[model samples]
Target: MPVITSRDHPLVKQLIKLEGSAQYRKKTGLTLLDGINLIQIYCSILGKPENLIVSESYYEDADNKHFIDIIFGHKPPKITIISNSLFRAISPVKTPIGILALISIPALKEQAYSRKVVFSVLLEAIQDPGNLGSILRSAAAAGVNNIYLSKHCTDAWSPKTLRAGMGAHFFLHIHENSDLKHIAQQFKGTVIATSIQASKNLFEISLVGPTAFIFGNEGAGLSKEMIQAADENIVIPMPGKTESLNAAAAAAICFFEKVRQERDSILSSNIGTK
Candidate 1:
């Protein structure tokens, strides 16, 4: 294991660049996975990370030796041990977990909506990394395989988003920098968007078929073009005094409602077949 002492080391500088700049991440096709959980997830879903950076403390700590052994088992990648301070310098979180993995972003193909989907999500201009991550997590939990994002959305692979997403990035096929209007108009299935004034109720509708849900920016909400392009503008009714829902909360509710509807549909189909 190589020990990187200086913050100015080429590898250290590269990790900083990858964390600090989305453009750099895009240019290099590289991103940092913070913590052991993310690194383990990347290893399981994709493969072993290209490089693993460990804090010197972890290297010296007798108790954690087995953890490191688990990481490098058999086919280990390049390993570098740095001082706790130097490790923290490259860490995205304030409380450093003493480990990181450098890996190429999985190349998820961005293609047009050719066939109808059982479930898909289109996100428009979501700027908050946390919100975007939560939405992605929810989408994955709901069994959504495909997601499209507008150009203005936050970088999905950023450490904050990745942490917030909590490994959803590995499961999801994310298409970034998409044309929202074009996708909304071109989508073959039921394109649904939440609107306060809409007469349609979200639970009343059928989400069993090819359905795509559109969620908009946190503050500005959906663009007029996207809403206009959608096949249906439905609203999640809140009889309570809460005037509005947080973007992440709303997304989760919308996603799981589809899950519920689909479950019911499957049961009904099974009964009919019997």
Candidate 2:
């Protein structure tokens, strides 16, 4: 095929349009995975890209060539090698990786919705994409099995959020605009909602069974409806006078505490068995 030399090329414009809108990606059923690392993650999760765009100069390099060959080893997609300047035009990052892929977004399978999900992150009208992305990265680290985002939450598929999340998006089961109360009802375990003013301390609370954490937006915090919907309200004890911790920071603390407790429990059991 011919090289796409112009920034206004139809495919380039289409990919750029997906930069801001999740709706466009949903409608088109195509999501842009920027940079080599993210594209590699995409390949690992979603299979070979339907199409690959690369900078011509980088494509000629032996190292990049080998990496591209590895990625395309299974069944190579149509590759569009363009000039450096043109690649920069399409890239969203400051230091463009000069590589990107447009891949099909996998449909959420029936198995993804489970009544026995151990841990999940709940986003209530979180507007900032960075915070949402950071929370996702933290959640993935802390072993969260799913993420439930309210209708008003930031677009998880947007470019900025995707970049911040790195490759966390692939591993997460994200359900958008889901009913918080109904989902919580399905989960028999504890429902913990975090806030600054809550009477109970986070560490003191038992993270025993399946648990869901509700973290609200930075400015508004958890809404009354979300708080009421939760089974228990808890707070991360702060000895200092800091009014509130960042939403993402607070989430990391809660999630890791659960992980630590579970890990210690397993170790204690093994020691007793011995």
Candidate 3:
């Protein structure tokens, strides 16, 4: 394994830039997976990476040696070794993971406008990376196959967002820079948005068919245009006197309510057949 001791090494400089700049990442079509779990997910899903980077401070390095020697050494792969200090500089987190992988970002196909029974979520101007990530994870778990992020939302592919998503990004068809109203206009099924002024309750609506849930910014909630775009304006019933829910939490509740409704519908249909 070749060791990179100098800060001037081309790979080090490139990685430092990648960690710091989203524009650079987009330009290069590259992103770094910071920890072992993420690296493992990428490898398991997409086969071997082009390169692996390890820190000198990594304890029990023989495991990596095994991986490199067997799985990664097909073509004299560059599993570059570097000092701990250098790794810390390139890492985004406060505590650096011992190893990382340099790989091309996975390019998933965009979800086309279709009349099919698809479950979707449209996010507008969600600024928090952690919140965005949590929403992605919940969306995947709740069977929302399509996600549309407006142009004003934070970068979905950033390392922080990626970490927050865990491996959920692989499962979702994420569409960015979307037009929410246009999507609502073209949608075949119900378009639902939450509001404080809504007369209807969220639980009363049937999400059995194709449904699109639109959630807005944390502080601003839904804009007037987005609210007008929704086919139904409903409120999540809160008896506890809370003003509102966190965007991510509200999204999860909305998703799982759909899930619960669908499950009950399935049971009802089964029973009716009997």
Q: Tens-digit lDDT track for model 1 on 1-274? A: 5678897899999999988999999999999888888787788889888888889987787766677578668767888899888888788677798878899999986656553446889999999999999999999888887899999999998888998898999888899999888887888789999867688988888887788999988888888888888889988989999869999999999999988987888899999999
What does each candidate score in C-alpha RMSD? 2.3, 2.4, 2.7
lDDT of 3: 0.84
C-alpha lDDT score of every prediction, in listed order? 0.86, 0.81, 0.84
Higher-scoring candidate on lDDT, 1 or 3: 1
Better of 1 and 3 by TM-score: 1
Clashing pairs counted in every model? 0, 0, 0
- Candidate 3 lDDT tens digits, 1-274: 4668889999999888877787898899888777777776767677766777889867347776675565445563456889888888888877887787788888877657463358989998999988899999999898887899999998788877888888778778888889988988898889999878889998999999889999999888889999999999999999897767888899899999999998899899999999
| Model 3 worst lDDT run, 10 consecutive residues | 68-77
TM-score of 1: 0.93
Looking at candidate 2, the ten consecutive residues that score lowest on lDDT are 108-117
Angstrom error of the Cα, residue 207, model 1: value is: 1.0
Ranking by TM-score: 1, 2, 3
